[model samples]
Target: MTVIVREFQPADAAAAVRVRRAAAPYTVTTPASMVNEHRAAPPARRYLMLVAERDGEVVGYANAGLAYESSEPGQAFATPLVDPAHRGHGVGGALLGTAEEYLAGLGAREVYTWVLDAPECRAFAGARGYRPTRTLRYQRLDLASAALPEPPDVLPPGVELRTAADFAADPRPVYAADVEVTADEPTDIPFGPVDYEEWLADTWNDPLLDRELTAVVLVDGAVAAFSAAHTDGEGRYVSAMTGTLRAHRGRGLATLAKAESLRRARAAGCVEAYTSNDSENGPMLAINRRFGYEPCATEVRHVRTLG
Candidate 1:
């Protein structure tokens, strides 16, 4: 079998989505999301979406982009996913090779990729000069089986609950809150200030994002906690990001927003939901555990310094 790697075209949208879904089923994605990721990519990001074709069928894909949102420079990510059935055929290696060359050409000195925590998966990255950095988990919740905490009758003083849709005219406040919370998230590296315009283009306007299903907690009429929700055309919802501002920490607002979001999600016919967290994040993990979410899968973040 001959495998050829090439840039993705409009016609390859469905194939790309299929390859991604088959390779990583934890997140919900669509052809539109793939296209928008490229179209909305900033110049500094240098984003590229590539696919591997064998016998005229796409069996693998790689998404490479500079970490433009990070305060630091020369940071990039090239996440390559190959169909499990085609793992030994070198499709993954080829995809990584192309992704590295692209990122290097775009001025990236350090690249980070998430590899499954398995002997085979680790060896694949090791052979390519990647080193283990940290581990993250993909968690799942059976909305039908889990017993969620009851919603409080009334929020604490000066605290209110809302949704992302409530800030239709001006989402900058939400964007600011997101930037602050994301900066504090546990990671190998820190993300500095966020660009509101870029956040609006990539996150706020994402096609899969469901603002109505998203839950937000407001304190004194300002954004404090939020749980971003995503859904496929099917009945599955995922919590993309759930965080509370530092000032609101220890108040259980994160849990409040997440529980409300899950309740709204199930009421909207969503039967299952998913979320991910850094293995070292105890606070978030405890919040998730309280909601009966269990570990379903794990992926390790690997880093490689380019020479």
Candidate 2:
């Protein structure tokens, strides 16, 4: 029987999560996030979540969509995966072809995706017209064995520690902090100005965002730095983003926030923590290393321009 690729259905979600996790274990994923992403994507995004089935079993999953939030025109993304148990088949190639065709029809002139750094994965992307651009390092810290720094007995002058939950009644300040930090992140594609409504829908409302586990730092009552926490609800936690406002750089605010977040996560029964950083982002990478995060995997970002 031929492998079949089609739009993901509600019934295919569990299989899709398994397939993606098998192919890419470095990132945090849950069935809820997977389904929420597909449902919450704005219409302008034109997001299409696709899954591949072979012999009546789902073995591949992919998502392709236009970059509606990007001010840069002709930008798009397509990330595809085939389960390790099913890679010998042509599922990956079939998914990519379909994704590219959809993107082309959407008037996207360039396509980007992250491929695992392994030789076979690199070769697969290379043969598919994608050229490597930047490398990202995926790091993991064994919270069970980590020697997390202890919070000081006395608070630093004029500094206060809080959790994202503290601002539940008014998350605008948290959203504002997110916007400022995200804009400064180093990336291949610049995220266009983020919309408040979209941010609320796609990020703040995510089921995995445990506000109580997310550490926030306040400098004189202003949101200065924070580490967003996403949990799998099963002892797996990821620091979605650790960022400090430009004004707060060099003060170790980000490091403080992330450390507190991780310590709290471990105490919350989380056994493992993971995060990714661009190889060139020396500051954040150093912070992770200081926190005992060891490199587990790497991904090479590849881009293909449509003719």
Candidate 3:
């Protein structure tokens, strides 16, 4: 069986989403989200989504792009995933090779990708010269069955809980909080200063982000913490990011935000909730566990240097 690798098109969105869902069940993705991501990619990212087809059926795909937000130049990323049913047929290799060639032509010096913790997945990456650098844990919460913690009926003095929707008129505060919290998250590549315009366009306006389900914690009218939520409109919700300002770290603000967000998601008809954290992010992981999120899968970030 010959696998043909080609650039992804709008018509391939559903097939691509299906392949991703089959390969990575713990993550939430939808056809619309896939198409929007491709259409809305920043030019600096040089993003390219490749689909691998076997006999006219898309069996795998790879998302390749430059890490434009990273301070380090020439850093790129390429994640190739093959449907389990189509594995061992060279689909993954073909997709990866095409992605690498494209990135190299764009002057990529190194490429990073996530490989499942399974033995076969690790072997495939290792054989291709990718070495593990960091581990990421994916967690899932059955929101429909979870006994989520109840928010206090009486609010703490000067504290308030609000949804992202409330900030529609002026989201700069949310944007500022995001910049502060994201800088503190653990990552191999250090992110450069975030551009407000870019953040507004790429994050705040993302098609998958459910502003109503995103909970924010305000301290004396200041954005202290927030939990960004994403939904597939199909009962699958994901915590895109949950963070607290440095001054509010130990006040349980992040937890409050996440709990409220989860509750909101459940109420909004979402049944499954998913989240991921860098293995080094103990605080967030502990918070997720407290929310009854169980470890569903793990993926290790692997890097391959290019000439």
Candidate 4:
């Protein structure tokens, strides 16, 4: 096979989305989403989405960049996905190599990637100097079958539910709330405060983000909690990120937002919902459990420090 790894082109969006679906079935991806990612990537992150071509057909892709969201600089990530049918043909290895080289050129020292909890995936990362760090479980809920928790008839005083669309005119409040919640999320490495412009580009403006399906909870006229939702032109709903601000902790705001989001998703004809959580995030795991979400897949966060 003639293997060529190079920078991704807008024309390859369909092929890239296909490769992602083939490589990771649990994740929902679309061509439009791929295009949005490329256009919205911040320069400081040195973001590069690369594709592996074999005989003129894309067989794999890699998302590489510095972890600009991290307070600790020099952190980077390079996630490579190869079509299952084209695996073990050096496509993945080549993509990883190309991605690492590009990220290193952009001043990345430590690279992190998520390796699926499969023996082969572990071996592949280990062979490339990447070692297992922590595991995250991908939970799935059957919106068509599983019984979702009922939304409370009455939210606590001064609290009201809304959608991301409600803040379209001015989203800085949502941005501020996101920064606070993201800072408290469980992860292998700590992340810095959020960048509003970056958030607007990479997150708020993401094509897959369904503002209508995204449920938000406002307290005292302020964004308190939200369940950012995404869909891939299908019935699957993904909780891209769900969080509550510090001031709203222990108020069941997160649960309220997510529950309402899921309910809305079901009403919109969505048949399934998915979300991932770090193993150490007990509170989130418990909340997900309460939503009838079941562990469907797991992936381990791997790190490789290059000299």
lDDT by residue (1-307, candidate 4, tens digit) is 7899999989999999999988887788899999989999988888899999999999999999988877788899999999989989999999999988888887888999998899998999999999999999999998898787877777788999999999999989888988888887778778887678888998999998999999989999889899999988689889999999887889889999998899988898999899999999889999999989999899999999977
Task: List per-prediction Cα lDDT, in the order shown.
Answer: 0.88, 0.91, 0.94, 0.90
TM-score of candidate 4 relative to the true fold:
0.97
**Which has the greatest lDDT?**
3
The deviation in Å at residue 49 for candidate 4 is: 0.7
Between the candidate structures 2 and 3, which one is better when assessed by lDDT?
Answer: 3
Give per-residue CA lDDT, model 1, range 19-47, as digits (tens): 88888788788888878776877776788
- Give the worst 10-residue stretch by lDDT in candidate 3: 192-201
Please, what is the TM-score per model? Answer: 0.97, 0.98, 0.98, 0.97
Compose the digit string of candidate 2's lDDT tens values, residues 55-143: 88999999999887777899999999999988878999989889999999999999999899989999999998999999999999999
lDDT score, candidate 4, position 120: 93
For model 1, the run of ten residues with the poorest summed lDDT: 187-196
RMSD of each: 1.2, 1.0, 0.9, 1.2
- Show pairs that collide, candidate 3: none
Off by over 4 Å in 3: none
Q: Which stretches of candidate 1 lie over 4 Å from their true place?
A: none
